[model samples]
Target: MIKIITKVTLAVLLLAVSVSKAQNFQGQAFYKSKTNMDGSLKIESSSMTEEMKQKFMESMKKEFEKEYILTFNKSESVYEEEQKLDAPEPSAGGMMIKMENSNDGKIYKNIKDKVSITEEEFFGKEFLITDSLSTYQWKIEGESKKIGEYTCYKATYTIPVSEKEKEEYANFKNKQTDSKTQFLMMDEPKEQLISVWYTPEIPISNGPGEYWGLPGLILEASFDKTVVLCSKLILNPKDKLIIKVPKTGKKVTKSEYESLVQKQMELMNSQRGDGKDGIRIEVHR
Candidate 1:
């Protein structure tokens, strides 16, 4: 009995040491994130041919094809974009269409303390948005897939769409009654089902962007018209990285930050009120 007890104690010590080593190291993950435009783009220009329009759409698609890096330890993570060379500016005829993508900000999450902070820059000003970490009710499915060397399991959640946005999209689609305009109507749902693939081999309850709280590290996520896939992962490199909280912007709650952004967008729209000058404020979720 004493020999068996000694063996069990030694095994437990070895397990503890391995877990400590695994949790203390830092890791980096590369992701390619692409989000499609919510509604079909309608550009009414007599100077543009169908081929020109197609080229313009391709350019627009390239705009959203972005790369991001997620640097993480056991309890905290920082997710930000990887900068690339700028493409030539797209030329639009007859009108200036202005839009905003709120997802360009940097996000930091600390799962140990249940806290999150995002540094957002808008029109030259930066704001720090502080809030609680997001809690997702992810339903794990029996399905499995492989992303690189790790096998990932499927999980999903849902995001409900608002009625006002639905009405606005419907109106935009039906406004093609004019003789000079052509509109393409599409069927959009009231809720978007978000899916993710996670691997328990890298056992950290974190992921890229505003997603986390799984039993493992999320390797890929799909939602709305966007898909964020992990292209590469490096664990425990030669040089260690510092994972710290963000603290460079005006501090505010998440709701307060969103309200301020809405007001600023409204002011900009009113200032640029012109028939040919169109301003559209888009906040991607």
Candidate 2:
């Protein structure tokens, strides 16, 4: 009886090990991101001709569409953009704007540890921003939809506009000489509604960019004028994932990083004669 019991216990242990190994899975998810540029063009100079405006809008549209890859496991993920070669220079009056997108850098998120490390570059300087993971109070609805081959459930969350955002909005509104531009700026919401479609079939509480805390992998997410959709997914590829936290750059918290960026922008603006038409910058992930 003792021998039999010992054998059974050893068999159970082996089964547990096998299960653990199976659960330690890794995959890669490809995402495509696009931003709406209509409202942005409306805020441009009213004196510009329609043809010039159309050209500018067309140039901006190409910048708005981007591709990213999220390599993740059950608890951790690293999201980054696939590097691209530089495009040809823009036409006169078509300023090349450096807009922020979802694929900023090596954003490492560990769900089990509830921590995140984001490596970002500002004006040629790298900063390692470390902070606690943002926990979203997601309201999961009964609605369901399909993104590609995966069935996804709908979820919603509201993000309050920060003081910086409010100030930027006010500045843009004030600078608009045209009534239509002012009206369009005013129509923009103070709070952005984030909509997500997650698939329980993936069984991983992970998503692209800064979004997570869902019951499953997020296949689609939209907030403000930006939308990110998963274009491809590969589960348990033969290549093992090496998840590592970024260690380079000046370490700072999220708020600290924002403050630093704001100060830098202010300095730049002051150096540029405080011109209202200098550049409107917004960072999103």
Candidate 3:
């Protein structure tokens, strides 16, 4: 009994040490999105924290969940329509974040509400959009540079929409005439590119938008010229952050969600000054 107890104690101590090392540091990240000439969007994400890792880990869950609504200036439009900003369009559909210190450690998570077009749930639906919207291969190219005190690397990718893609886009537009659903449409592809600057210094693989799996942290990223940034990075916070995913809104996949929104928009357009934009449909299990 004594020998067995001693072995368990040693194993527990080793496990604790390993976990401590993993959560010992934290950093900040910034991301941006842009459009290429070919009707696709690009994204970049960077990490920008130097000495403080814990503070960032603690508050990051809450900070990253906050939305940054963006609007395009008409004068700044690359395409004539791109400049005609009608409303706040979503760049990052919605995000679900889960942070754990250890495999079984406490989890901090947050799920934001996506603006629902139909009263449908979007929780587990696979996004209708494909990674094919943009085709760009990126490679970590050259020595690291400093951005706001943290070292970052240069990674580049280019997106091009071909002739076949254009034909397919035309087909989708043909369906928009009297259709109640709004499918993903690509009108032009002249400005689609994604560039990223990251640092493997922090040792974590996560960032805003679809940027992830880098060796270090992402500090600054840009997709075309639309930018998302980590305005601040905190490290070694005295308190551990606790996050709970919210279940208040309907869940849908990215493409389906977009489709639902289009349906609602067309419905509203048809009603035009009649003033009936709120209709609720509930599903009972």
Candidate 4:
């Protein structure tokens, strides 16, 4: 009887392992912007930095230009609320974020460099978005880690000033790109350390954030010190969607394009409230 019980336990454990391995990591993206000096996370546009506002407008402009056909599947559970099976939140402690991934090709449209092709160009039209304006030497450094039961290799990419990058930096130093912020100078290299975690268990060359070119799926990613975690996996769910990059729009590099957007946003803000007689509210107590 004891032998039978032991055999049953072993069988159950093996089954669980098989099920876990079969599950693919399928869930909506949850983004948590780093906190601010006030110890709070600002969600709206009215409370963003000039650079942040510029990037936001740039995204909008790219969408308008590309006009890519976009679609999204309904939200799956984020798994935050364990008590409630129907509706699960990603994080139960403190604040759990709810976000949708910009799945369509439009998200890549703004990337504009050596990323992907659009729908407009001829058979062999070359559209160099960022014209070798800079080249930063990047290195991968870190320890190996495991995201799920899968073993993952962790690495850090450092943005250093290469020869081409320095030249662009000098050009930007002479003139400000726009009123929002000055461009990076050759000597002044802004360092950004991105931690990438990829597992060879899943054979796909993709990741959560900007890090890519791995043998398998990227389980987690971090940029500018903000972390994006993959909490769940859903293997081979029905109604699988295909990812194809679109190609039907005028191309523009990220930096130059963002400057144009910043100007427009600044103009709008000026009209709304530029230190002169802002929103008037008379509260009667």
**Tens digit of per-residue lDDT, candidate 4, span 1-285:** 999999999999999997664444332332222311122122233344556544543433332221112111221111111122345333312223322112222332222242532222222332223322123233445568776687887766666556755665575455434333311112354666667677777655444433355555666666543455655555445766444444345576655444544454344444543434232111111
| TM-score, cand. 3 | 0.46
**lDDT measured at residue 200 in model 1 versus the true structure, 0 to 100:** 96
How are the candidates ranked when ordered by lDDT, highest leading? 1, 2, 4, 3
Distance from true location, Cα of 40 in model 2, Å: 2.8
After superposition, which runs of candidate 4 have C-alpha atoms over 4 Å from their true positions? 1-114, 117-138, 160-189, 238-240, 246-256, 265-274, 277-285
Top of the candidates by TM-score: 1
User: Which residue pairs overlap in candidate 2's backbone?
Assistant: none
User: 195-226 in candidate 3: lDDT tens per residue?
Assistant: 67776665665444444445665566676434
User: Positional deviation of 265 in candidate 2, in angstroms?
Assistant: 2.9
**Model 2 per-residue lDDT tens digits across residues 178-245:** 32222122343378799999998887899989899987999999987889999999998887888777
The worst-scoring run of ten residues by lDDT in candidate 4 lies at 72-81
Q: Count the backbone clashes (under 3 Å) in each candidate.
A: 0, 0, 44, 13
TM-score ranking from best to worst?
A: 1, 2, 3, 4
Report residue 204 deviation for candidate 2 (angstroms).
Answer: 1.1
Estimate candidate 2's alpha-carbon lDDT, on a 0 to 1 scale. 0.77
lDDT of each candidate versus the true structure: 0.77, 0.77, 0.40, 0.42
Judge candidate 1 against the unseen true structure and give its global Cα lDDT, from 0 to 1: 0.77
Between prediction 1 and prediction 2, which has the larger TM-score?
1
